[model samples]
Target: MITPKASPAVFAVGSLTVDVKGTIGGTYLDLTSYTATASSVSFNPLGGYDFSFRENDGLSSKRTLSISLRNLLIPSPPDYSESVVTERGIFVYEYDMKSSSTIAVTQPNPNLYRYAFNDFKLSGKARHTDDTREITCNGFFLLQELTWPL
Candidate 1:
């Protein structure tokens, strides 16, 4: 017999926050967009006609998070402070997604994906125009592990 297919789940952004030495702070409410990138490098050894072996260098792996927010009159605290940029903290991205209804029915909670950057830095450039002003923060995630809640 043919089996039925389940519907695709819909995921939405819940919130983003930074944790500094156990103190958590929220970003401006006008956050417009955010993106994350995880990457690594690989080496390939070529034989006579084709590649013989492929290897991945664990040390080359890196993760980075970038966020764009609407400019606020007040300056961001330690998260964006030059004196504290080198400090390590946890960057969290919470997501709300539709769960599978076939197994169980219940209220959905936001799922969190946390990244522990050994040396988290908050640096960005702000652009001002006649309409609006936005700032973008792009920094390194100096670690390789990402924690998830199941």
Candidate 2:
């Protein structure tokens, strides 16, 4: 008898929470989509013509998270407060996905990927009548943590 392989899992966007001054916000704007990008720098040392050496520059790595929210209605004062535009805060994003039997059997049935952006600061915000409002944030790095079905 042949063993069946585990099926692929479906992943979805869970939630995005903004922590401002120890208070959590971001309930007013209807978040539609978001994208996270991370980049690292590489260094190459001078070597012989036949040999080359390369190394990753961890210190120059950066993480950027951009979110687009539908402007269903006007946001309240606290939801998109002025502080969010002026001050720096922390952003937490959660992604959930079901796991295959083989993976689930060893770990949790469902997998949770939590990304925490420290020293996250608002890079820009754009709003237009014909376009969705977008918020861009940049951070030094992202701290990724994993949790089992919860």
Candidate 3:
């Protein structure tokens, strides 16, 4: 019998809520803020994927904050295929402090202090069918996690 190699670990799925506040840099940056909820179990694999390189807690975007998610780990080893797939769901918006109305995931033009979504919501039963699918559980599920940059 062959067992599908599992990830090193799995983060239990749950509801999450977060609120972010910050101040801009040299020019008095205060144009960024975020409120989020932890991804819960959904029919889709990306129920609660939320990770970003923006300011988690700071007076400026000069510094960034992030965390790693287990789902980001590819179950297939390097020996096999090297396919890059979406592991989770992430929602990010950018605002030009002065122009609070303009919200976007990224700046119209790239800048030194810009950021983007490196991850998305991964929900239950995700990637459960890469090449195999036979769970003892009544139902299988996938969970996308948020990972931070080093």
lDDT scores of the candidates, listed in order: 0.24, 0.24, 0.24
lDDT tens readout by residue for model 1, 1-150: 965555322222222222222112323345333333333212213311110111121222212222211211111111121111213643222211121111111222333222222233332322221122122322322211123333
* Number of the top TM-score candidate: 2
Q: Which regions of candidate 3 fall more than 4 Å away from where they truly are?
A: 1-9, 14-25, 38-64, 68-150
By summed lDDT, the worst window of 10 consecutive residues in model 2 runs over 48-57
TM-scores for candidates 1 onward, in order: 0.19, 0.21, 0.20
lDDT of candidate 2 over 67-136, digit per residue (tens): 2112112111111212112145433222221211110012123343222333233322222112222332
**Ten contiguous residues minimizing lDDT sum, candidate 3:** 74-83
Residue 83 in model 1: shift from native, Å? 25
Native-vs-model 2 lDDT? 0.24
lDDT of residue 60 for candidate 2: 23
Pairs of residues clashing in candidate 2: none
The residue-by-residue lDDT of candidate 3 on 55-120, one tens digit each, is: 233232222222223233321110111122244533222221121121112223322112222222
Q: How many backbone clashes does candidate 2 have?
A: 0
TM-score of 1: 0.19
